[model samples]
Target: MSRKLISSGSEFERKIGYSRAVVDGDYVFVSGTTGFNYATNSISDDVAEQADQCFVNIAQALEEAGSSIARIVRVTYILPNRDDFQPCWPVLQKWLGEVRPAATVFEARLLDDAMKIEVQVTARI
Candidate 1:
């Protein structure tokens, strides 16, 4: 199939020069998403809440790209503080249990202090 771009309507997408997700052939690549509530442009202060929102955002991008969480084949979790990782496990397990895609986690600095978690995924359409 030809390339198709899916957007989450985030202002940063154009400013940063990237789509929220891209569909090429049978693969859909979803960009790393944070907990920033697109409606309020605000992120949660709690890590677990942030992780939950990350999945919500990811689900939208995947669904819009003609894919679903069930189709996800890979996932990546980016956390600024490694200690906060365990608190977010239940949120991850809840959303990822069915797909249980290949996954990785990293402890790295994020752009914003309020953002404790960011998630990215890949799926087959």
Candidate 2:
């Protein structure tokens, strides 16, 4: 199949020149998604809440790309504070425990301080 781009209508997608997700052949590559809820145009401060929001945002992009969370084959989690990672375990397990995708976590700064977590995933379409 030809490559397809999915967008969440975030201004950053236009300003930064990146799509929310890209579907190529049988796989969908979701960009590093933050906790900002496009629908509400807001983000949470709590790390665990932000982590859950990150998944909520990611799941939407995946669905738009003809994929779903269950199809995720790989995942990467990013947080500015490593200490915050533990608080997100339950939220992470809630979304990914059954799928059990190959995963990694990194402590890194995000574009916005309100964004406590970011999630990127690769999934089979």
Candidate 3:
């Protein structure tokens, strides 16, 4: 099978040389997605809101790749501050619910100081 690339038209992909997501056979790998609204290219400073938008962005990429959050098998969350984890976790649980995929959360500085969270997902369709 041939590999397929998915782009969400985010300028970062062009600047950073990466696709938003890639599909190979039954699997899809999504790049770390931030909360910036692609239409407005704006990201809020609120940690919980940013976390929710991050998942929403990932869901969109997954959909473009012919998959959904329900199909997600794993996820990795990167947070600049560990204290932000508490606020983000409830939002994540609200979106993912019982369909929780294997996930890991780690602290790391983001590309921008305003970016509170980023999420990367893997799924099979």
Candidate 4:
């Protein structure tokens, strides 16, 4: 089997030594994506907005890997504050309401203080 890398045109991949996503056969694994506006390199502070952006980022990566959100098999959400869960849940539901892949959420400090949420997803192409 062979693996293909997916890039989001971000410099962080070179600095971090990891691609935005990687596809091996029918499986596509996306890295933990933050709510960042690549054009400005800024993260939104609103948990709901951040969650939405995270999903968007994951969706883009999956698309590049020849997959889509409906093909997602699993998802993991890391949040800086547990309290943000309520606001983020609805946003996630809005994007993945029908797909409803296996999901998990954890409360922990992210890479940065402004990063309220980060999401990782696994999908089949």
Give each model's whole-structure lDDT.
0.92, 0.92, 0.90, 0.90
**Candidate 2 runs further than 4 Å off:** none
> Which lDDT tens digits does candidate 4 get at residues 1-125?
58999999878899989999999998999999999987677888798998998888888899888999999999998988889988887898888899999999999999889899899999999
Regions of model 4 farther than 4 Å from truth = none
Over 34-96, each residue of candidate 2 has an lDDT whose tens digit, in order, gives 888777888877889888988998999888888899999999999899999999999999999
Candidate 3 structure lDDT: 0.90
lDDT of 1 at 30: 95
The numbered model that scores best in TM-score is: 2
Model 1 steric clash pairs: none
In model 3, which range of ten residues has the least summed lDDT? 36-45
Off by over 4 Å in 1: none
